[model samples]
Target: MAAGQPVVVLPENVKRYMGRDAQRMNILAGRIIAETVRSTLGPKGMDKMLVDDLGDIVVTNDGVTILKEMSVEHPAAKMLIEVAKTQEKEVGDGTTTAVVIAGELLRKAEELLDQNVHPTIVIKGYQLALEKVQEILKEIAVDVKADDKEMLKKIAMTSITGKGAEKAKEKLGDIIVEAVTAVVDENGKIDKDLIKVEKKEGTSVDETELIRGVVIDKERVNPQMPKKVENAKIALLNCPIEVKETETDAKISITDPSKMMEFIEQEEKMLKDMVDEIKASGANVVFCQKGIDDLAQHYLAKAGILAVRRVKKSDIEKLSKATGANIITNIKDLTAEDLGEAGLVSEEKVAGDAMIFVKECKHPKAVTILARGTTEHVVDEVARAIDDAIGVVACTIEDGKIVAGGGAAEIELAMRLRDYADTVSGREQLAVRGFADALEVIPRTLAENAGLDAIEMLVNLRAKHATEGNARYGLNVFSGEVEDMSENGVVEPLRVKTQAIQSATESSEMLLRIDDVIAAEKLSGKEAGGDMGGMGGMGGMGGMM
Candidate 1:
């Protein structure tokens, strides 16, 4: 070693990008991901058809769904995906807006960095701007009520407007609102799981219907059992009605044939006794979580009971919520008090498959939406759209607040953020203004997707927001002009907008702060096969982003 020479400590197999190189790569990765999904924005947005290695196809315009389906490896790109996931988890809508804003924030920050502004100042500016943005959103949001069915329907329609289900937005909107409102508990808390969506192809989207109770994709266990029951008394059983077998294998030594006959009779009698218990409880409808043996089915049929076997555990829980029934673990414990009442329980063949529908409950906390379509892909996409609609409506019901859609919230927020940015001093002011500019991506992308002049629409929107009581004005893609979104019945849950902005800002700030990246290299095939020592697991992540 030469004097005054620094010695290399890092492994020769390691690859590192420092300072400008790391930031540039990270920002470019984010922009690429953002650009990939930017076209799928607004009502006129296009859909993405993703096919995996297994040849399974997914057609969607939902931002989170698209991101989840992609094989993303870049660290920064994955963070943007997380932003979309968080937005979807929190509000169920506005995922695209969140991701687009994050990408634009990074793009704007890149320019500021090129101008020699420090990253810490940029992050601080974004933080301050985030706080102010939240305030502006709250001030502009309109109050909503749980009982306002019309407004709630509008929110649902707004969420479903841009997806594959837009053609049936009116009907789906009503179904979404009804389903969500049906599951709201007395405490005004909504468990989104309580709303179940079942997709069946070979029917038009207009044929979709909402059921006041749960729908299990199972049929009667026996052909002799009743196909339909009126004024149904349901018995939800977790235990099997069949005779219990010994856990350990044992040889059965029969001395005579008559002994075997007696043994068979005894087993039959045990199953009969179990069926008698169910019949005695006045349960005409039975949903079993376990199997029902042939003998047990005969006994149940003889008692004029409708029985379904091998029902899923989750379905059993949903049945309990919908029918107000307590699941009985043992048949011997079942009684009239343990049974649940539904006006009707019937098995119907839908889309050439058997499914049991329990409907007309007094006030079910769980309900099902049967989504129908003409094709498999159409049905899948429609189901996803309904899922998003359900999520947003539930959010509105819980938050009791909404804001005008059609990019109105973003435009108003940008206007307000710019005004606030002028009050700040130093280099942070530029970052605050950058945030304001980044928000315009929503309106601009909306116009671009609609094939309208983005500049003209933005100019009109800004002019509109410049006037009093015009804060709710936004671009109407169909007319190619700015109009009040509220008057056009375009509105969404406040959570969607706020969540998108917050997640976007946070993710962008995190990406902007990254100034270095070190990736470990993988060993060659022969060397890797020799031994595992000195080989780090991070070798698989080499060249990421």
Candidate 2:
């Protein structure tokens, strides 16, 4: 480790074209990522067949998945990848939104910088505008009544279908509504958070069940342990129920008979005492935090108690509840108790589709997202979309409704944004107008993908926009409110509406203020010029892009 001078690896020059600072580089990189994948969100959105520098092809429309595949080396290009990841993590379905919004936002910010707007000023205005968007969200949120089951269906179906799931969209949407309605208390408010969403493949929606009590396939050391427990008094333990002691310190000693005898007596007594304590705690079924001990097991089973051993870490998390004998880890550290339910993982098969459904969980943490399609992969992709929709629903259920699957609502929103641009202030209104324009891509992409003529699709969408009269546009994930869509078959990425707003608002605020391109990348004859080095995760992300 000799250090005369610090290692000064130079940045690739591409960033210089954008700007020298960290912010400028981020803008450049973000633009690359967003523009690269912007057209991959809707049905009409272009599908990218990203082939890596090494000849591997990725084929899909999932933004995170695609970005995961794409290889990017330029520092500027990597910024967009971060934005895409941010979108996925935040909304579960807004990768394209981040790209489109970030791309355009960068372009706008670059212009502002050209016009002598300080990066600081652009950031300030964006912060203010962000608050305004919250107001927009509050106002845009729709209210439904007791008779709004159909309305809910409209939202669900639109969300499912928009993501291109066909076979199970309408059915699952209705099923979701039924599942949600099953647990709604007498109170007028429907806590969407209470319903859990688990994703599975192979089994059709028909074979799903909702259980009153939690059931698991548990086993003890001996096969003779009970397979079933009735009226089970369950104690959810967050520690190992097994009797085996884990390694704590490295040691070797066994010279004296007295020492050996003393150790044996202590361990036996401790095991017996632990078992007695567990049984006396009124727990017939002990869910361990870690593995269980053997002697502790013998006493519990002899006492007619059910002792489970070796639960996977994930299973432990799903079942643990705080503030109960629900044995949480003694250590202060623990996973968040989203609910006392696990996701649906099935090995059953029914026809072509694998059996899939959200299992027994009333907590908002437990949700079964049902998406559909003809093929397994297609269904898988749609299922992924449904999962993203779950998050979007989480964020918006309090104040939003679903639109149609074909980007109909997005187009409407875009139009409105343009119309209202004049009413907004300064360059910010122009940014909002741009947001409206960007939204139209959803429906337009859907129409294009469905094989409709571009101009004709636009006309039809415009006509529908006028007729629908500016109602909220989204999928009815819980109800069967979609029609003509399956036949026409338009799809969007998961959670298009809210995600778009979030990605756009964020990117605009972040990007529009960039002052200059201090550095930039220049691709040259096979190798990208400038020393941006290899982007860690962006390789082969072309499929979704």
TM agreement with the true structure for every prediction? 0.95, 0.65
What is the alpha-carbon lDDT for the whole of candidate 2?
0.51
For lDDT, the strongest prediction is: 1
| Predicted candidate 1 versus true structure: per-residue lDDT over 72-159, tens digit per residue | 7777788899999998888888899999999999999999999999999999999999999989888988899999999999999988
Which stretches in model 1 have alpha-carbon errors above 4 Å? Answer: 1-8, 247-252, 522-545
In candidate 1, the residue pairs with backbone N, CA or C atoms under 3 Å apart (3 or more residues apart, or in different chains) clash, namely none
lDDT of 2 by residue, 461-485 (tens): 5665567664344322223222334
Candidate 1, backbone clash total? 0
In candidate 1, where is summed lDDT lowest over 10 consecutive residues? 530-539
> In order, what lDDT does every prediction score?
0.89, 0.51
Best by TM-score: 1
Q: Looking at model 2, report the run of 10 residues with the lowest lDDT sum.
A: 338-347
